[model samples]
Target: MEFWKNCWNCGHDTPQERVALEFFPRIVEMFSKKEDGKVNQRVWAVFYDSYSFTKCKKCSAPSLFVDEYWTQTTSPEEAKCIAEEVKINGVSKSGNLVHSHIYPGFLKEPFPQWTHDLEETYMVLFWEVYQAAALGLNSLAMMGIRAIIDKFALDKIGDIGGFAKKLNTLLNAKIINADQHALLEVVVDAGNASAHRGYKPDNNHVKICLQIIEQLIGIEKFGDVINEIRQATPKRT
Candidate 1:
């Protein structure tokens, strides 16, 4: 079986070919609720959980995957189509992907790879938080964003009181401008809400929060390199 996915090792979406003996319907539990609302009633509702061991065509890295497929959710015609698809292409073309557990897991999209060159802790934490956001763990991702900022502040300028003070200090020292400070304030507050108030942000909201952090991390990591480039440029005078 072959399917497309973003390869963690290659950092790109590529075709993956599962081993010929790779797939199996490992478990099927009573998934749907009965009309009678009884504990042990049988209905037309069933779901399949399957596993696949595949190799990334682009990078040749092996990955193990568990995919949850709700078969009864689709119409009979669609089911027929899926069956035909499986016959023709050797892949299931229908079903909602409730979860994808790809071993040596993957980021949904490529993030700032240059961040790996920064402090090891921040580098590791940033990727973890990024993956959390990708996995729709908005609350956890928000808390992680806050923690990264806090760690960055402490590493740059010690434990200088609270968020407000640290943000101001960064702005004053030109590490971040007024506009960037305002954005950072939003990120921090979102994190606070998620951490302390049990806030679960919508996907769009989480995306904006993550984007702001991406910019902040880019600046934090590449700012010095950028300054060097500016200095080396010939003067117009």
Candidate 2:
């Protein structure tokens, strides 16, 4: 079969074709039994787990194509079932199974679109924080989060100061209220610790930080627009 996929080795999007191979069998023991007046078949038909080579039409790199087969019924006369591209390996007795390779370039969760509206430096820092969190680098993620606050203040307030001072200025300017200021202070403290004292925040800690930052950015960029939309919307009868 022919298909298109991202080639991890060559780092390109390429077309691929599967190559077929001759099959051989491995011996696995089987047994059967009878209960009451009925005959019960204990052994199912053999499944061939074979690897065929797929060459990338663009990069010419060979990837392993998995072919798996099994019997659908206990009767040997029944036709076999086939799966062309089985991703998961066979399950273990303990119920454990191995999965196929996942493309790292594809994000399972996407970053918010509001990020692009931020100033260039703020956007860069915010995306760095996101990528760090995704890669499980909690300390670096915290540091990036801290840097985002600094960049946000600089872009919005046009001043350079410590994180706490910036937060105070934003509070005085009515950019954030008392409750928001208090929450931001907590994030600032955590970020400072991660940046200066080599503290590694846990997943929950970083998640809270990301949530707060996302909410703040959303409000800052969209608050007036949201109010306008709400006013324009008709009330239900």
lDDT string for model 1 (113-144, tens) is: 68768788888888888888878888998899
Tens digits of per-residue lDDT for model 2, 89-171: 21112211122332334444567788888767777888888888977889899888777777778877977578788999999
Stretches > 4 Å off in candidate 2: 1-105, 227-237
- Relative to the true structure, candidate 1 has a C-alpha RMSD (angstroms) of 6.6
Candidates' TM-scores? 0.59, 0.53
Cα lDDT for residue 65, candidate 2: 46
Q: What lDDT, from 0 to 1, does candidate 2 have?
A: 0.67
Clashes of 2: 0
lDDT of 2 at 6: 53
Number of the top lDDT candidate: 1
Q: Which pairs of residues clash in candidate 2, taking residues 3 or more apart in a chain or in different chains?
A: none
State residue 39's C-alpha deviation in candidate 1, in Å.
17
Worst 10 residues of 1 by lDDT: 20-29
